[model samples]
Target: MKKERQATEGLVGLIPRAGALAARAGLDWFLLALIGMILLAWLFPELGVDREPLSLGDVANYGVSLIFFFYGLRLSPGKLKAGLSSWRLHLVVQLSTFVLFPLLILPLRSFFEGGEQELLWLGTFYLAALPSTVSSSVVMVSIAGGNIPAAIFNASISSLIGIFVTPLWMGLFLTSSSGAFDLGSVMGKLVLQVLLPVVLGIVLHRYWGVFAERNKKKLRIFDQVIILLIVFTSFCESFARDMFSGYSLLDLTALGAAMVGLFFLVYGITSAISRLLGFNREDRITAIFCGSKKSLVHGTVMSKVLFPDANIVGIILLPIMLYHALQLLASSVIAQATARKAGWEATGE
Candidate 1:
């Protein structure tokens, strides 16, 4: 069965173009852009916050739907069905994403029980609840000569599952922490803004899937623009409301350190789990890369829905943004090393 699975690994081709692009994305550029957004927000808060002449937030809300629509359009139903058959691989990746990550962080809640620090913990928890990213996960796995089919399957399926699981996990504390969390209203907005558009895109895929795929690089840029807009406006509100007042350089540095540690912890555990489950080299690589990533796209959009306060949202999104950047930095090096090691082994050096 293991050999049979290995034989069918080419169900999808390794996307070097995407891998190269993703590798560049994992570089410091995006992280610098994120920091630049914050600085811009700090300098010109009214630009994003003011709604008199225009509102970037409204534009972001519309963009969010379109992002998900393209997200769904790219999802090939036939491939999804095939991926479903690999129940064990899917189970490990999904569980590691939604379950193991959260469980690891849950223990530290005591250290940050209340105050501004509590919000940091909440942000960390939010990071844990998010689904794995689609592009980077698949890209890194592909670069490592992993199971491309399963990587695509797990990454795609994780996004769909996150639309539901993320909120449910968040609701556990969102309502209690802040009265702004109206689960019913929030989910309704997500259904219309996130879910419905995705369904529509999927239904229209046969007609437009090629378009979406052909223009995905363009669409991804669009996604990043919308996200930057969202981030800008969100922090604009945060700055206006003095959300980062309590957080100093040290505080942020500590949080950033924690985010790095969190990624390694999850990565280490998933690797161990893959070994214990007797996954093949390819399957093991897929599990480790896919299981250890989190979706910044979902985290950004969901923060708008989950935490209504722009002031609170800066803190809410802080952890994910940091984790996203750090994960990319760390994963790029790891992926390259893994690829090199594999090559060395294959060549019997």
Candidate 2:
């Protein structure tokens, strides 16, 4: 736990130095904020666990619906239609995200067969099962001079796809492990919370789309607020329940190292596949970047529904949060290097 606090402080202290780049990538400060939120939860568990100082958990639930609604608002049908021409690119990217990632992790399932390590492995698998993120993935691809249209399309489509696929992938384990998740029931609720809000927003896009786009930065802050609430509440429950009691620094180190390894493995595989497919420079960059990302937005909100056992939700989220930070740092450096080597400045266009 001390290790985490130290790490968190180090990350948070970098916020000032990264001000310019953070505007484009956004993950740098958000990563620090996440660590701060967790530390806050540790200091005052009652803020989340006791349902005091306002019902934040309930508010976060409402925020989830609004997040999707705004998501649908930004996604115009014409943009989606225009990006559909690259069928092969789409196929490889999506498979790399939803299929290839999970398959690579499945081989390690045997090592965590019924022990204290089971949940750790399950959390790692949860990270793999998540979708590519939106803003950051597009930003990274753009910085690297990648296929922007295809990146936007793949990232958007991946979120919608994970609305079904992520839960289904998780169901395979939940059904046997705890029997808490009713696939049919969860699907119904997801349609109401996730799908319905999205469809409604899409329907009203013509009317409110401009407003949403104009205030996108504010909307993104709203998303960040909601994510912070969820993280605080989740960690409050875990801390209150003593989930981290005996969790050693060595374990945290191992997990961090493992997440980095997982990232490289997926990234390497995607790069190889992109080369084999004879993709152009832009297309290859799009494939590798989009294929390697996992969305923390989807991870936290979906965990609200998927894992009802609030105490362990924090543990389930641990892998994604770490992966989120590492990916941003590594991707930013690589993106800058790629653009520099290509003799072009990253205009973030």
Candidate 3:
């Protein structure tokens, strides 16, 4: 019994060290956590799918609201107003996130119509229509020595804009995709689950904002845990219905490749637009990072509300999940490279 206890303790102790090593290696821990959750769901599908006494979906729903609440608490209105002067950067980032992305995907609809691939295409379009990531986009811009204030402003504003715009964009064709999409219900839920919490947090920011800012790390972890729960339960529901059976290895590979290509294309376009606008390097990096990111957290939460049908929800999430992972991997590398270049120049190297 002593030896058995020692072995378990040793195994537990190794995990944090492994995580630190992964961080040192530039391997994203969230990606690994996501994979672990998916595997766990695959192994014990009943836990997340079976609506037991403890339902993960319900927990995730509430957790998502809290996530947004904290997000609001962290966003200072003064900072937002201060950064509003950078309208050029804001316009480019917002346009890239909403207009350019969906437009880029629109032309491919005909190629995917009347087949199983239509779902994939719709999912990809949904991903495009979603907002820029709040946390990672800012983090990447900060790392790249970009305009941090502009990055924060754009990312926060993007999320706020998406609360309205994403549903509007998806509403145009969601009926075609899901046979019926109740824009009213989706809007209500967005207000309740996403927007309302943000408003509440913002209102209370004066009292608790300092506390929230101090514990940003904890809140981020909390956010990630909620996301993982959502991902696990989502995939569990998907596995329960065997929704992934139709997806071949080749199809997944193609999806990943498409995501990679889309990121680069958007990145290139954003960079060019910044250059055309006579943006400094800092503004360009902020625009590129903020404009190129799509929020998986928003995608997953909105999927729950937008696509009420469990079966299709998984299909809708696939592209976003892939894009989420791809962006992190690509953006981190770019951010590090940009930082290194800046450092070299600073040192006259």
- Models 1 onward score TM values of 0.91, 0.91, 0.92
RMSD to the true structure for each prediction, in A, is 10.4, 5.7, 4.2
Candidate 2 residue 133 Cα shift, in angstroms, is 0.4
**Candidate 3, residue 47: how far the Cα is off, in Å:** 1.3
**Total backbone clashes of model 3?**
0
TM-score of 3: 0.92
Which number leads on lDDT? 3
Q: Which candidate ranks first by TM-score, i.e. highest?
A: 3
Better of 1 and 3 by TM-score: 3
Give the per-residue lDDT of model 2 (tens digit) for 41-153: 99988789876567889999999999999999988888888779999999998999999989988789888777666777888899899999999999999999999999999
The Cα error of candidate 1 at residue 332, in Å, is 0.8
Give every collision pair in model 3. Answer: none
Q: For each candidate, how many residue pairs have backbone atoms clashing (under 3 Å)?
A: 0, 0, 0
Better of 1 and 3 by lDDT: 3
